[model samples]
Target: MATPSARASCPLLLLPSPPPACPSILATKRTQRRRRILSCRAAVRFDRRDVLAGLTGVAAGELGAHPGLAAAEDASVVSCPRGETVTDKLLACQEAGQKPCPPTPAATAAAVDFTPPTSPMRVRQPAHLADAETVKKYRQALAAMRALPDSDPRSFASQAAIHQAYCDGHYRYGGPAAASKDDAPFDVHFSWIFAPWHRMYIYFYERILGGLIGDDAFALPYWNWDAPAGMAMPAIFKDAGSPLYDANRDPAHLGAYVNLDILNTGDTVIPFDPQAVQNNQVVQNNLCTLYVQMMRNKKAQDFLGDKFCAEYPSTVSSGTSGSLESMAHTSVHIWAGDPGSSTVGNDGQEHTGADMGFLGTAGRDPVFYSHHANVDRLWHLWATKLGRSNFDDPEWLDTSFVFYDEKPQLVRVRVRDVLDAAALRYSYDDREPLRWMDARPTPLLPKGTAAATTRRSLLRGAAPAPAFPLTLTPGQSVEVPSVPMPPRAQKTPAAGGGTQPDTVLVFDRIEFEPGRSGKFDVVINVPPEQAAAAGPRYSEYAGSFATLPRGGNRSGETAVVALVLPLDEVLADIGVGDEDGAVNVVIVPRTQGIKIIRPPRIEIRER
Candidate 1:
């Protein structure tokens, strides 16, 4: 997917819209949520920097005739190369026309409200910790699904195809990439839909497995990648002869520790050595990464992703990926996919990525389900342990998707129906997030340039910022020194009258060429002397984000890429949690070929 000789003249610029002033009088929880969402959608800044778009017309996909949100016909949630391109290599099945991609069963077609399973709650255990009997049952269930004919809806192949059709295969002819069957192609990734959709996907899959094994108590095991003990590829998934094994995973990673930050950094650039790299450091890094993804990303939108409030917003297409979906979840996929360091030459095909690495073939691997089980588990913990809330928007609540249950019946379910794990009759065996909560990165003393170090001499809000729309090269990094943290005790009252507001670091906007994957790592507050340590191993290493190659930017429109990172844990770990002065923004390029259209800024946002 090459860019045209010329690019779009008006590149999409996403400025942070301030959350509304907290109401003078307290509002109901639901009303407060609505106001927060409306305000987040109200980011129309018209400073001397650039003129913001206006509400000349309603943006597509928002509830019809909304009073607050505005959109121009030209506006888009994502901006791609001038023409839509397919960056994802996983779509070869769809491209080669192996089988016609199925249109999404209409949410209106034979749709029934989801009924919570009457069975007792199935507690999902860690794949590595399961006993011999549990492993045997799990293996047997998968073999049963595999034994079924491809035509059977409950067959393993059919289960994999559901992911393929909805995510990678939606655009056969590629007109506008609408969610409806007539318009063609619907995607569940890169939006609020990611969590709920996957929850239902595995839920039904779990049900089918239980029916196969005659155990209603069966639960899907999660790949507890967040903890030290469960970091390696779960042993159950490594046996080549087992039904659980995936032949396409990286050979080098077979027995190595699962490095959560193994995407652009892992691509054969670092030598594969489980013994050398797997240490207390890697485990600590994994924990901090979880803390950042779960705690830092507190707001419903930031955690769940861009709101999928209504019918796919073909007009406001391309919602931003939530922190979890785009960060650890994605990195793990690449790590497990065939040959993280190399292209798909071994198979004599130049595919984009191997099984777990690419979205199209992710479901082909059994470990993928366990991986998502962890993701879903974290969502459960985020909501329960942190007491966070999902989006309360009606469209968010009503958005529906279709699936096949163990009964092999076509069933349609909505976002509202899948929000609760308890209601769905499932729970993680190990729900406590104890080991990693306190694993925030330790700060190393600064030994470099005064300008690059923490602003001891520089006055608050006085340091010069980097030039806007900067292009980053692989070897060269940019450090935006002396950025102010979101001030404590801000005007915006805490949600539900909580103790304090959350402060976050926002990397304003980054652009991507259509069909080409997007990549970057965010490291905050590290001194210049310790800059070399800007990775997941250190507390300053906030997160690494990747947007898998895709068919196109949302509706071939402009989509803003803003990376919001919470600072509560990082600031506290580095002993600056109580302070609000300037911290350095160090942008490290883990891989090559990325451009930051807008620079980094700090804001006081509630998680």
Candidate 2:
């Protein structure tokens, strides 16, 4: 919708001639009529392509396959030349009872101002942000409520009431541009980015808690899944203050829905199963599409209510398990800006179109995080099943992200920072891991099947790993792909084991020439059955990374490092099955003259 300032100046800029006899009354009448007619037209045919035509005063027919005007052109009553003179024709027609062309602004500034522009950095406060007293009261109510049984459904029911009350107090109409503004429309959906958004959102809730409980000591806990004890649903999720709290969930229903077989499939175990990786990608894309639709929502009540959440009944879950694999509700995380080359586009280009800010549009409602915590929790669970040392993978050691700390300070966090319960500086003693309950006594299969398929499929197929193999040089990186692992049946490197366990595989190891810099990338492929098996057996080449010096950024000498050793036969000890599996490793370098960060262990599972 056009802003008031834009509308107010429309007469001055578009109507360059002196005002007509009934100009004031005519302006108001035209404004109302246009709103009644054009707003409806705008709703159906809106796209980025039409923004230029809307601003340039071009004929709507000349929109030239621009998606933005499709709906509007289809609905327009009088199809005429939409030029700079059109506005005058329109006004003249309103008075003369003959259809006239809509006039375009004589001055560029007026047309530019009235264009349906995107809000790059607009921040609209949710109603809950108001009322210092209500936030204070609610915090106190939450502390008292914490003492209630964590397992009891009533706990979440009560907390949900508090959430509902707060939501009721502060909510308002988000506006019409809610739809298609961002890649995500505002509705309930959950995924990895969910927890991050909620962490920020719940900070407000915690501040309210601090005020009411009279203790600034109150810190909301993340459902810790680094270990089994930290994996259960926390009291906060079940607490009565949570708008999303569900207390009356049936255990039998949960048992039927939350199958361990589907939940524990770690990406590492399968590495890069092409099909599984594709499927995961599909899920993410579908979600982004759905989220974009939700942003079109005009009413906050429909968003806050369960109506939107119920759309994906199969995905949403009541417990932590159900939430992770998929959410019956909407939880999303919107990365709302351009992130440069790191972004992968729908067209698979280096930089084709707007990709990042798609998530923060007005259409996306705020409940995206609660849904993602569940998905993130599931990822933690998958990591555990791989091995406690799974986090020790050199690939994860230096992974970094920017987030606001408790002191409201911006800081970079490594995955290692959250590895230990104490180091993470939080606890989730109340929520238990899936292991706390009975494990399936037999290999669980889908409905009506007694035995499962022995021909296991790939879980996460190999693309390349993200680690960069720095050259001995300090500031370079490149991609590395390890040579294919020989079949396990053939005797190679270290007697019984295919590759030496202690040797690290540099997927993207770069070789430097005399006084010069160079780089390359390695790729790895992991099979499905082996990924599910989870033991350190078969090894696939993962990807490699490398970088180079600023001035000497060019390809140089390269070599391969192959080591074979016996990995610790601790798979059975960690609840992993000893089975055949494969992983392909690759390395990619950003530039040259940089050292490639290498993996700590070597490969053995080869024929």
Candidate 3:
């Protein structure tokens, strides 16, 4: 067993050529001397089963060439060295303030409490208005902040500068007295570098955000990416025709291309399989290569990008798929690598890189959570589509992590605790959400509508209306004439047809404005017969709002919502579930004269 330190350094040095076969007595003496060296650091533990297993795989001729060694094989023990070199390195890491080791195997065997305490509902100040004007103001503020000197620790850029300073400060790895063996070449076991490094880096950035926007009221808005339209670079990210903004590369290019290089080593340019958008293996390799490059180059932006525009998952998952796990996993996994290939720190001392282990580099990337957000959303969608909920896996919950606090205090985090998005205190809105696995439908809106919908509404408090209206204007109300239901299909034993109790919620359009939001009131008069069962249930809500021609679905036969709202309110609403866990709503957003965009439903279960 090679000690971790023995393997953390550069690859094995070129060995000297050995002399021709020596006299048996002399050879025996030399072997004994080498064995003494090996025994000091490592002890051989032999088991009959392993020796027998190896012998069985050998050919008769090969076995005959070394009959004595073979005869002793069943009872012979192979070298299992515990390179003291690793122990010495661990000591050095400790002296230099690296993360402390886990208390001992016995001490850690007990289960840890990873359950997150109930989260207090946050009464956050409303989002800062993001109209063109506000966006401009925010950008200006950011620029001013970035322009400050690094010594002015009051600014975020300054705080980040501190980390850069410390990278060459007391945190430096390896010392003069460090053993040569501990400075061996790199391999997979160096992933430990990523976890600690990123943890520190993100903390610095987060503090910067807290400093920029008052921490109490600020929340970073993600780019709604579930919709293809939102996937493009928003005007907000550009300096307007500046060479920095490549419209084609805005939404996916920066992160994807950089990550592709990290994991796949600047592999193919075009898609691996033209028919398949992102093949999994290609994605994995792409991420691995990208991280390795980052580690080798000592360039974090090489992977994370230099500007806020490139910050990830900050862009929302507005695409049709409604899932981002595969991409996220590729991102985290590559930051570390599969066991080890490249991507190790070059300190020639402490092991650093994903090669150190999965928890090393992968856990360090601030992108990990953003990546997991997509994974979590995918699971949510899977539950809805497959009629299931909750990923109740013991194995998942059992995964453990040791994170360093600001004081470098080691704290443990578990996978189960991360399952809830609210617990994480972040929310992502998916703009396109209509997904049925293989069905990639055309957008309900016409050409130019997607981009048009992205525009902020002139009316302050209402959902933007394209060519159709989903709500009434302020102080206006119109009665929606009730329509009779169509006759049901005749059920027969031969046809195997039976009624599927309707769990769908039908609504007129929902409306909202910045200050004055619209509300749709419905009288749920529960029937006496079903009242006993009308309690909380986990239900999937689905609905769609379409902007058809003026006369289309005029008979009131279509199940769509068309409402209007005043200019100063916010979009705030609640949903209820039905008996036996059944409820689904689909919403489409459109106004009479404007082209319409289909919106995905917001799923809710009675709380």
Candidate 4:
């Protein structure tokens, strides 16, 4: 079996010849914009499985026979006026434009020497808690980064490029031939790799920022969006004259408190009154979300996500995203970015753009690092406080990604090396234990406690009602009839002294239209008028359906996705399972700026 490094080194050899005539970089501005939009759309269409299997081994004989295809594939070898060589068609696309396109930076080079950090730095606190000195250091570092020319590797543009390369599949596999296969874009999201990948990304970014200010002890402050006091955009980052501030953000959200719920819609653009009553409610709900995502998800697959396999015969997944990444992580990204900003030409069409909204451009904003810092801190809490363990799979442990070091040299890092933050020489400032865990309402009977009746007296009950489908269109909602608990979930003494069975509400065969950014919130037992009140709070809220951008395939073939939510906690919170035995589910479309042409179908299953 070939090692990952060995396989990655020669991706071009495994691909087909490049296509003819790259899109001219010098094309009219209107044409360039159109091509960019089209290219991004096309890029999302190809499935990861097909990209890994079918595209890697196209027969060279077929290409050799077609002389034009062979020539086009070999065009990367043609030298440009500058001392740079075109590596592939994608590079050609980039080169054709007015800008100079350098070869994609590699993890290792013959001329560069790389070394990992040896000393450790104290972890920084949340932005609100950071003292004057720490804030000054952070601000100065960012200002210095802003001062650097775009050409420098440590500059903001190049750093953002590194992220885009991984997320958007800018780097081809094998060699020049790899350039022809534009469909095979490499993506780090929607997999077990999401947490670790982001951790590594922010670690280096923090290091670079520290280096810029000549403070090896400097640490990046987290946004701390989970707490009420820290919920608003950090004051330090909001100053217009500050280098950390971006003009592209939604002006309304500059100092507004963040709503952990209502994430699918661009909350930044929505009017926020910040009533004390609502603010307090959102804070409690945010804590519950954190508990559910971090502590309630016990299994590795539930928290860290499904495994990622990039080799042949191993199909890639949008993978089942863990609760944290899907909810809080995804929500924060949408919340921080401007929904109305027109960085990309979605004019007339409703959609958010610029730094935080889109995947490709997210890294450009300085807040992205702070946002990810909080995410990393949560991961740390899960591991240390919740006793969660990292995946032991070799594929996960051995997977390597390239990142630039403070030395500004590209270094190859493995997932295993980054599993511990202390080893990386940084730790977060000490904080108190989560108070939310204690705030949860006590269960009727302690879990695993036996009922008063014997096994013979406590008989299994009837089956639940037939599963029903609910369809939701853009800005529309539908409520399904209440679903009853399965007989197995009823309270009973264990046959062999086992723990009480846990019940779950499974949304099976959930399907969404391809190429749309529409999402829906799942609220349980909430009346139509009160649906708006349901969110990260307790029983009233369930979960959400936020599909990632389908890789450029707009074939309209919707993939069936399922959401498995634990019902016990929600039941306990609502104080209802014993009395009502059934709960109504409401599905509300979160579409505000974007349109979902095809309606989504959701089927509820009780287990």
Measured by TM-score, the strongest candidate is 1
Evaluate all candidate structures by whole-model CA lDDT and list the values in order: 0.57, 0.24, 0.24, 0.51
Q: Write the per-residue lDDT of candidate 4 for residues 439-547, one digit (tens) a residue.
A: 4533333322211111111123212222233455545555543333333334354576643444555443355543345467776655545565455544456667565
For each candidate in turn, the TM-score is 0.74, 0.26, 0.29, 0.67
Candidate achieving higher TM-score, 1 or 2: 1
Query: RMSD to native for every prediction?
Result: 13.5, 25.7, 27.5, 14.1
Better of 1 and 4 by TM-score: 1
Q: Write the per-residue lDDT of candidate 1 for residues 506-551, one digit (tens) a residue.
A: 5545655334456777666664445546775565666665766444
Ranking, TM-score, top scorer first: 1, 4, 3, 2
In model 1, where do residues sit more than 4 Å from their true spots? 1-100, 103-108, 169-186, 264-279, 309-316, 340-350, 431-433, 446-466, 482-486, 489-500, 513-517, 527-530, 551-560, 568-581
Q: Estimate, for each residue in 134-240, the C-alpha lDDT of model 2 and write its tens digit.
A: 33444454545454453221232222321221111111112222211111111111111222223223333333334345545444333232223222232333345
Instruction: Compare candidates 3 and 4 on lDDT and give the better one.
Output: 4
Tens digits of per-residue lDDT for model 3 on 125-185?
Answer: 1121134543444454445445555334334333332222222111112322222222211
Model 3 ranges with Cα > 4 A deviation: 1-211, 223-227, 230-235, 240-418, 434-607
